[model samples]
Structures are given as C-alpha cells and as structure tokens.
Target: MADDPFALFDAWFAEAKAAEPNDAEAMALATASADGFPSVRMVLLKGHGPDGFDFYTNAQSSKGRDLAENAHAALLFHWKSLRRQVRVEGFVILLPDEVADAYFATRGRDSQIGAWASDQSRPLDDRDLFERRFEEMKRRFEGQEVPRPPYWRGYRVVPAGIEFWTDRAHRLHERRLFTQTDSGWTEGLLYP
Candidate 1:
C-alpha cells in the first residue's frame, strides 16, 4: 500500500475518469460553519498537484464562508457506475489571487459574467430574475474582457486523511485509509 494518499487518489481518480460516463471530475465538497453545522454540494474538481486539490467559488458563498470561518473541509467522490467512492478530509487554504485570476480568465466570457450575476446560496425571487440578471451581465460584458470578481477565486484542500473504497460481491469491499502523521503517512486497511 502506498503511504501517500495523493498517489492512491490519483490512481483511483484516473480509473474513474476513464470509466465513468459523465462528470468524472465532479466531487461532493463538504464544509462546516464555525459552529459545526454542515453543508455539502457538488463542485467540479479544477486542479490537482502536490499542494492539494483545488476548486473555485465565490468567497461570499456559503461553502466559501464556511471554509473561511473554519478552514477545514471534506470531500467525497462517488462513481456510481463503478461502485466506488473516496472520502477525504483536510484543511483548506485560499488560492493566490494570481492563480484565481488565471483560472477565471480561462473561463468562458459568459461564465465569467455569470459569476458576478448570481449571489450563490442566496434566496432568489424566481428563475426569471436570474435569467434577467444573466442577460444584463451578458450585455454588460459584451465584446469586452470580463475580469474575475474580487469575491470569486479558488481554494485548495490539503488533505490529512483519505479513504478509498471499492465494492465487491456479497457486499464485501476493499478499503484503504491513509492518514498524515508528523513524520509522513500511516496506511491501514478497514473492514467493510
């Protein structure tokens, strides 16, 4: 077993990316407020490196604010078609402004504007209001460079714990857990 969770994650993720029919890069991001109330939603996995896993969102969004307050988060990747799932827990850090700027610039112009149009996690009057706002943003940014909003950027979750699970016959499963320690990583098998 590999002591590095990231290596194991990469292996499993590669398999899913090749075999999963859709949204292979999607993950369920979980966050909690300072008080410990939890919330979760699906987000696209944007980047990965030795530093950690990255995703982008508005800083004022619920998940973003939760991370700001607590700086801790969890992630789950489930590939229903493959009967596999991975769970991760970690500390989150805001990405540098330059990194966010580059990523935002790469986004479609309409999407860049839409980031400024919708107030994520806020109650909306109706779909029409959202459509109207989207239209307004489209008009405003038409034939122009759409800059990344100050409130929009990316966050990286530096994982401390990760568990990979795979299904088998009779409900038996394969489970491997990797946890970071002061020295390095500790790997173990879990009964499933």
Candidate 2:
C-alpha cells in the first residue's frame, strides 16, 4: 500500500500518458449547485501535485457558479487502454490571479480569444453569432496580447479522498483508497 496518493497518481498518470492514444489528462469533473444538484463534464487537467489538481475555466460558466455556491467536487480519470481509473473528491479553492494570468498567457491565441468570445453555459440562439463574436475578438486583440477575461479563472481541488482502481482477471479488480486526516493520510483497500 502506498502512503502517498499524490505519488501514486504521478506514477499512474505517467503510465496513462504513455499508453493512452488520446488526452490522458482529461478528467470528468462533477460539481454541485447550492441545492446539491450535480452536474458532470469533461475538463483537461492543467496541473497536479500534493497541493491539488488544477483546471482553468470561465468563472461565469455553470461549473464556476456551482463551485462558488458549493466548494466540494469530484474528479475521475479513466484510461481505457491502461485499464485504470482514479477518483478524486475534494474541496475547491480559487487559484491566485497571477497563476491564472500565467496559464492564460501560455494558451494559444485562438483559445484565448474563444475564452473571451464564449459565454459558456449560457443560451446561444445562433451558431453564426458565436462565429462572428470569435472573429470580432480576433480583430479586437489584433497586434496586442490578449488578456485574460475577468470571468476567466483557475481552480485547485484540495483532495480529501482518492481511490485508485485497476482492472484484473475476470470480474475481480483492485481498489485502493486513500483518505486524508488532520494528521496525514490513511491508506486502505476495498473488495474488487
């Protein structure tokens, strides 16, 4: 049994990156509204460590609003080729503006513009209108570095529990769960 979930995650993620043909960093993020209604969507993992898993998004988006109202969330990474998955449950924390700014700077110019153009999770009456907005943003930032929108933000999830699952022969499997405590972390296993 590994003592550190983060270290185990690093190892498994590295293997997934090598084996998975597509985005190994992709994870399903589940967030709840103030009333505890849940929603889930796929998001790319921008960073991770003992601190937590990081991802960036538009703060006005549904997920953002949900996070604001309910700080708790869950993340799941499934690597089909590797036959492994990691589940993370934690409380969300807002990343510093500087962190968001730096990551925004690293984004491709088009994506940076899209972040500004898209009013995510909002009703869109027409697709062409969005295209026009995208073009308009491109011209608006022409010859200048596109800045992060006020609603664009970064978040980190400080994990409380992490479960590692692996496929095995037949229907049996392996399950290792690590739970956080005031002193540190406790590791245990579950029936496959």
Candidate 3:
C-alpha cells in the first residue's frame, strides 16, 4: 500500500473509473447547519488532489445553506465494484466566482436553463409551474449564451483527515488513516 493517502486514493479512483458501471465520480457530501442539524446528499466530485475535493451546487440550496452556516463537511466515496471506500473530513472553502462561471459555461443548454429556473431546496406547488419557469428562462436566454447564476457556486473541502478502507475475508477489513498534522500528514492504521 502507498504510504501517502492522496497517492493511494488516486490509484483506487483510477481503478473505480474503469470498473464501476455507473457514476464513478459520485460521492456523498455530509454537512451540518448552524444549529448542528446534519444532512447528507449525493454530489459529483468535480476535482480532487492533495489540496482538497471539489464540488459545485446552488449556494441557496440545502447543502449550500448548511455549508454557509457551518464550513465543515465530510465526504464518502464508495466504489463497490472495487470493494473500497474512502472517507474525508475537512473544512469547506468557497471557490471564486470565476471557477463557477467557467464550469457553468461547459454545462448543457437545458441544464444551464434549469439552473436559472429551479428554486432548489424550496417548495414547489406544481410541476407545471417549474416547467413554465424553465421555458421562461430558456426564452430569456434565447440567442445568447446562458450565464451562471449568482447563487450557483463551487466549493472545496480541505481535508483534515482521510481514511482508506478495503474489504477482507470474514469482515477483517484493512484500514489506513492519515491525519493532517502541523508539519504534514501523519499516517496510521485502524482496527477493522
């Protein structure tokens, strides 16, 4: 096994991309509100490295609101096909507007329009109402490139700790934990 957690993660992620039949980049993001209420949701992992893991969403959405209230989160990546899982705990950092704008520009036209139409994490009385808004947004941005909404934002979770787990016979799992220290990362093991 690689001594560095990031390197090990990179290798495992590569294998997952090839073996996982579905969205290999998907991950579960766990966050809490100011009042300490916790919530978890699936989000696509846009980027990752030693710096942190990156994802994007509407700033006014449920997870976004939670992040605003409490800038800490956990991420879980389960590559079932590979019998591996990784957990990350960290502080969230808001990415610049430029990053969100650049990513938004690359999205499909309908998705861009939907971003403007949907009031995510908010109550919707009727499906037709949202459909009308989608049409309205489409018409509003007709004959021009759709722009990124101000509420659409990107974030990174700067990891404080990371754990890598692999399955073993009889539930004797192999677990490796890496904790960020003042100088650098301290690698350790956990009974599993």
Candidate 4:
C-alpha cells in the first residue's frame, strides 16, 4: 500500500465501486453533541479527495445540529462483498454556496422541491400536511428552476486520521492506521 492515505483510499474505493452490489459510497456518519450525546446515520459520500470527504444535508436536521455544535466527526465505509471497511475521523467544514448550488442543480426536480418542503429532523403532525406542502412547492416552482434552500448545503470532513480494515480467516483481521502530522500522514499497523 502507498504511504499516502488518500491514494490508498482511492484504490480501495475504486475496488469497492466495482465489487459492491449497490451504494458503494454509502457510509455511516457519526457525530456528537457538545454535551456528549452521540448519533449515527447513513449518508452518501458525495465527493472525496486529499481535501476531505463531502456530504450534504439540511442545516437544521439532527445530524446537522450536532455538527454545528461539534465540528468533529467520524465516517465508516463497509463493503460487505469485499469484507473491508474504512474509518475516517475529521473536522467538518461547510461547503461554499456555489459548490452547494452546483450539486443541487444536478438533482431531479422533485428532489429539489422536496428539499424545499421537508423540514428535516422536525416534528410533523401528519403525512397529509407534508404531502400538501410538497405539492405546494411543486406548484410554486412550476416552469422554474427550484433553487437550493438556504439551509440545504454540503459539508466536507477534513480527515485527521484514517484506518483501513480487512477481514481475515480465524478472526485475525488486518488493520492499518494513518494519522496526519504537520508534515504529512504517518502510517502504522494495528492489532486486530
């Protein structure tokens, strides 16, 4: 494996993309509140590079609120078909408006409208009310592009550490941990 964590991630991700049955970019995002409560949820990995891994969400959502209070987070990617997993820990940075707008533009019209209508992580009295709100948004955006809502945006996780794990027979797994330093990343093996 290369000494560069990003390079190793790219190689593993490419293999995952080829072998995983579906949603190879799906990852478990873990966040916590400033007070110490934790939350985990599945999110799609929208983009990744040396800068970090990116994902989008409603700013007022539960996970979003957690991120706002505590910028540190972790992500886990598991490829069942390949029996491999990658763990990433990082600090979150909100994406620029233009970047968010560009990604939003690629979404389907209905999804765009949903983004406008859904008050994610909020209480809803009834499904009918939600549906009506969605319908209203659809009607309002008729014959016009649905702009990205102010609260809808993307965030990048600038990794401080990364760990790669591979399954092995007799429960003897392989683990490689990479920690970022001022100069670059330093790698080491972990007992598994």
The candidate that achieves the highest lDDT relative to the unseen native structure = 2
Across residues 9-110, which tens digit of lDDT does each residue of candidate 4 receive? 999999999999999999999999999799999999999999999999999999999999999999999999999999999899999999999999998999
Q: In the order shown, what is each candidate's alpha-carbon RMSD? A: 1.4, 0.8, 1.1, 1.0
TM-score of each: 0.94, 0.98, 0.97, 0.97
TM-score: the better of candidates 1 and 4: 4
Error of 1 at 116 (Å): 1.0
lDDT of each: 0.90, 0.97, 0.95, 0.96
- In model 4, the runs with Cα more than 4 Å from the true position are none
Could you give me the TM-score of model 2 versus the true structure?
0.98
How many clashing pairs per prediction, in order? 0, 0, 0, 0
Clashing residue pairs, backbone N/CA/C < 3 A, model 3: none
Summarize candidate 3's per-residue lDDT along 53-129 as a digit string, tens digits: 99999999999999999999999999999999999999999988998899899899999999999999999999999
Question: Which runs in model 3 stand beyond 4 Å of their true positions?
Answer: none
Which ten contiguous residues of candidate 2 have the minimum total lDDT?
Answer: 1-10
Clash count (model 3, backbone only): 0
Write the candidate numbers in order of decreasing lDDT: 2, 4, 3, 1
- Regarding lDDT, does 3 or 4 come out ahead? 4
